[model samples]
Target: MTEPESEGMVAQESLRHTYLQAIGVQSWLPRGALPHAAPSAPWVETFTWPPTQRFEQWEDAFEDTSEVPAAEQPVLPVTPSVNAPRGVSRALESLQGMFAPEGTPSQKVLESTPPALSETTPSASALDMSYQPEPVAPLQNPLAERYPEPQFSLVLMTLGELLIVDSLPPQGRQSFSPAHIRFVSALARSLGVQGYDINPIHHHWPAFVGSALNQGPDEALRSVRRLLGNMLKSQEIKRVLLLGEASAQWILEQPEPLDSLRGLRFSLRAGVAAVSSHSVTALLRIPELKAELWADLQPLLATRT
Candidate 1:
């Protein structure tokens, strides 16, 4: 470059540096360094700046002093004397005499005298006061231990009835169809039972027998009978009406025709009796079977009064 241009550039850089220093910004490089070749700025360490006059006064007030102030000195605890005062000394001596193993009066008397004989027999009242075995806690309810107790007695329906009932819309109605309920209610009334109240305890034939559904009818029926036994223990079921031939045949443990079994008395669980009859659903399909059902209920009616 030409001499004039180089001198002009040098003068401009000097002017910029002077301006920055005037505004309290320190020079970032050596004083005479050209602006184009300026070195990097070095980092400075930071420090916590201390407070001024007020804090200085606080420090003076908090400074420790060695001189003892003019006030009462703390009292040193007095050690007790080896010789106690008259009254306390006398009381101590009496306590020592009473508790001494060899010197005690009770000990001396016991050593000098023979042991007295114990009574030959304890009194009856003393015997009564002796420990007696605690009563055994009542056995846990057998039904609760086995399964959740179904609340209702005598569920009256065929095994396949659940299939039809479950298919229907489950809202604005009882679990069973209206017609079936009406027929059962009528049958219950005819038998002289008050309020045909029963919960639809199972849905689908499989639920009635649980996992036994895969094992054939006899196994399923056995499971159902076991379930009924639990119900008898848990609920106050007087009579379970085994509607439908499948239920009756299994529960009664007899394959006899409905004609022979309908009117006959059949024992079920220990305290419960089961009466066999045609289901109301079957009667709805074949109105003729209802006559036989009515006849079957006669024995149940006789005991109602």
Candidate 2:
């Protein structure tokens, strides 16, 4: 061959290899190279099928034959050859692995994710409402019913006992006991002054004294005396009766015996006459004390006149 013709053939060969490489063929054979051996027949599909055959023909084709007895038929164990092409073996292995029992890593992760707790568990309200406690009612005091405000008076009498309705004064009487009631009524008539009952320990009195005198019930004389003093002087009251030992000693600031103090006239800071007397409750308990009371009252009543 001439030099130019040889060069043209070399260029064509180079172009062919380049084209093969671009098409993803890793290797190529020379144009006149011998052909590769044909691939082995598929073991599973070696027989040809007649597409137009009836069902009966297919049954006849698959039917067992005694001429070729089961004992005479040879069985071959099919396995891939170790000497098989690497690509062919790899492809076969991947195809076999497609039907494996275990799932893919991604599939396993999806299964491992826990179900929502709300879906599996019961709600708190659904479990029970009994656990939530009922609201409690507040407490109330019967202070008004227990103690009522007294009618206005200059000569206010503080009593120790709380007279319930069952122990109330009888008809035509001002106190629970008839004798003491008569005595008090007579004294009021003689003195020309009105009398009203009060209690130092009365439920309402503490609040009254607190607001009026800025003193607590514990400072008995100071609070009660201040309150009474203000009332007496403000209302131009001339006299007050301190009944019973508690009333007299507390309001008068006098710790003298009741016997010594009874019916005695002591002047208050407000210039009101404070007459110490035996309580009606005590007079009822000991009727004989009335004589002593009458004796004591004569001097005090005489001064009033």
Candidate 3:
């Protein structure tokens, strides 16, 4: 090999050993210096094992007990006896002398003492013979009391952009009667709405009969609003016609009288216009209400036609 190449190889080996030693790893090196290599520091051998004398010194440290005094030694605990200690016995004797009659002995005083509670069992005579449990009232259903069975039902119909909401009779049939349908058909014709554009949506509160779900007025309002909001998304309804007091109460959450709410246009969520009027059932029963309903619808009719 060339002299320069051999020197470079030696230098690389030395650098590797230096790196290993710096990181705390013991690396083996040639005993004799490599040819053409620079003079390196002498390697010193280190021994970790202690000398024999050091082991002898450690043995002496553990074996030598002469420095510790006998008074500081630990003693085993003695088991307690049934009889009282000497000091306690003397104290009891003095107490008995002061309390008992002049001639009475400690034996007599101990004999007159009551039996230990642990040794005595309760007798039948010890318990009260006439113990009676207090009467417990029957449990009443809180859900039934808090929210009485909800009696609300409604039908929502849409014609083009005009939405109609009417409440059904709570006691009788649920769907719209023939007379009611005829009235709605006539109303649709007046607004120039075709029969194909008419769509009806039924909404009932509490959803499930005899369920524990909350069917209060507040829940009814929330349910109706959600129903209407979904209906509005499906169609582009610009106006809402609320028929009957129940319809206004459920949809608008208005507690005012039906007469007061009639003939006035209100704004619903999403900027839809709403008008209140008497229901078809009311119109059929009292023909006089038909004129009042027509007056309320004038504004809506003007916008439709």
Candidate 4:
């Protein structure tokens, strides 16, 4: 063939390579087939089914692959040299990978990226929902420190943890006891103390102190005194009828005789009196104390209402 004829064949081959890429089949062509390959036009980029006009134009120039498809169909993926250009072949293979079936998972759709923003909608890049957090309400104080608080006439001592409930005359018992449970419930009912009659566990010292005292003596006393001081600040606190010598001893730090009438009252101040009883069992028997505590509590219930 003359020189013009040879150049024409080369140009035809390049066009055929371009066409393979247009159909997303760049990997099927020979290596280095298009030495100076340029980016194909936009029509070629999205083209899937080859247009009939272009197909006929390059029909004879296409590689003849009639014999290669049948026997080696399984190994065709392992040999990528049979594909087209490096970039185009990679892209087509990637597209094939997207649709490639997975083991028993083919029915499920593969993960995709989030949708991008367009001119008609606000850019997701400028999202400001972070500052639009829910507003939090302020903390409430039920004991509104309104009146002149009375001093606790006397304090009974006991060794236990303390926790708080609502405001009013405050008290605590030793660690949980069925007898203590029964005692506080009846006393709470009898005295009309502001609380539920359920098993009295958390609203007192024994339940709360151990956890606080676990830290150390400084922490324990600070915590215990802090609890007691809060009770002392109650406007209704005139005197604390210490239910047990154990509780009384906790306040005074010297275990006094439990049954002695002389040890019953500890003079905390001229007006304040800390009196130890045997237990709520004693209070049940003592008619005068039941009346005194009852009188001490009447105004508290009215204030709560």
Candidate 3 local lDDT, 56-116, one digit each (tens): 3222212334486645533322222333233423433444333354334446455766787
- Evaluate residue 165 in candidate 2 and report its C-alpha lDDT on the 0 to 100 scale: 8
Q: Write the per-residue lDDT of candidate 4 for residues 97-202, one digit (tens) a residue.
A: 3434443232222443346667788777777767776786642322113211211112222211111121112343224446545655554444344354343323
- Sliding window of 10 residues with minimal summed lDDT for model 4: 159-168
Candidate 1 lDDT, 205-246, residue by residue in tens: 333435543544433454656765565656566666777655
Which runs in model 2 stand beyond 4 Å of their true positions? 1-183, 192-218
Instruction: Report the Cα lDDT for candidate 4.
Output: 0.40
Alpha-carbon lDDT, every model: 0.47, 0.45, 0.64, 0.40
- In the range 200-248, model 2's lDDT, one tens digit per residue, is 2231233342345543334433455566655554555555666666556
Ranked by lDDT, the better of candidates 1 and 2 is: 1
Give lDDT: candidate 2, residue 206. Answer: 36
Candidate 3 local lDDT, residue 276: 86
Better model by TM-score, 1 or 2? 1
* Collision pairs in model 2: none
TM-score for every candidate vs. truth?
Answer: 0.39, 0.34, 0.49, 0.27
CA lDDT, candidate 1, residue 139 = 33
The ten-residue window of minimal lDDT in model 1 covers 160-169
